[model samples]
Target: MLSIGELSKRTGVKIPTIRYYEQMGLIDAPERSSGNQRRYSRQGFERLSFIRHGRELGLTIEDIRELVTLSCHPEKPCGDAHHIAARHLASVQARIAKLKRLEKELKRISILSDSGHVGECNVIRSLSDHSHCETEH
Candidate 1:
């Protein structure tokens, strides 16, 4: 058996986050020691590591929960996991496109401030009035 602190250290997950995962039903509540401290099995360590990896990949908690359920049924097809990854990939791509548009708008506005005075600053003017933007960010 491992202490909660040891589990956190091994998994690179914070102690508070481990508790939150327990509350969220992402990981099972660990057994307590005689002194009331949490004691975790190797299975708990593996589960927490899985949760950490899923979170690092930007998977939503609900998605992670579903994935965990899917993991338990190894005989099932992997289509659901593929679908989840595809959806997340699309979201990431859309955000990247939006960021590119924002970058372009910033570049255009940044070059507009030729005057030393803020009163005559096109950058400030462009920001105050969205109409000056060539593209929607």
Candidate 2:
């Protein structure tokens, strides 16, 4: 068995985060030593490693919870997991599109600005008047 700190070190997750995960029911509450400190088994380490990897991949807590639940039943298909990933991918694509629009706006602003005084600056005027933008992001 490993102490909570040791588990944190091995999993590269903070002690507080581990506790939070427990509170969120992502991880099972560990056994306690006689001193009342948490002790984790090797299985706990493996479980935490799975959660940490899921989080690093930007999976939402709910998604991770579902994944954990699914992991308990090996007979189930992975379509749910694939659906979660596809949803995240769609969201990421939307954000990328929005960012590309913003980039174009910035480029337009740069072109509009001729280093004129602030009073006559086209960039400032464009910012003040959103109508100057042809596309709605």
Candidate 3:
């Protein structure tokens, strides 16, 4: 068995985070001693390690919860995890596309403003013109 501090050291997660995981019911709270100090079993140690690994992979709390539940039933299909990963990938690709569009717009403005006076600055002109918005009129 290990205390919370020891668990933190073993898992590389902060003490407060372990408490937070307990509060979220993602991990079970360990038994307490006469001093109200937690003592964890090997299972708890492994669970903490799993949670830290999930967090490192950028899993959301809900995703982690789902992963944990799925892990509990080892024989069950994990297609949902794959679905979640696909959604995250799509979101990342969409952001990359938007950033590329913004880069093009910035380059266009740069070309339009080169050596222009402040009053004639195309950068300012483009920003002030709502008609230039890629998202709207």
Per-residue lDDT of model 3, residues 1-137, tens digit only: 89999999999999999999999999988999899999999999999898898788667888889888988998988898798778777877888999998998888888863676889998888778777677864
Off by over 4 Å in 1: 111-117, 131-137
lDDT of 3: 0.87
Using Cα atoms with residue i matched to residue i, what is each candidate's TM-score against the true structure? 0.81, 0.77, 0.67
Candidate 1 scores a C-alpha RMSD against the true structure in Å of 2.7
Tens digits of lDDT, candidate 1, 48-81:
8888888998999999999999999999999999
Q: Against the true structure, what is every candidate's RMSD?
A: 2.7, 3.1, 4.2
Error of 2 at 126 (Å): 5.3
Arrange candidates, best lDDT first: 2, 1, 3
Candidate with more favorable, higher TM-score: 1 or 3 = 1
Task: Give me candidate 3's TM-score against the actual structure.
Answer: 0.67
Deviation of model 3 at 4, angstroms: 0.7
Residue 130 miss distance in model 1 (angstroms): 2.7
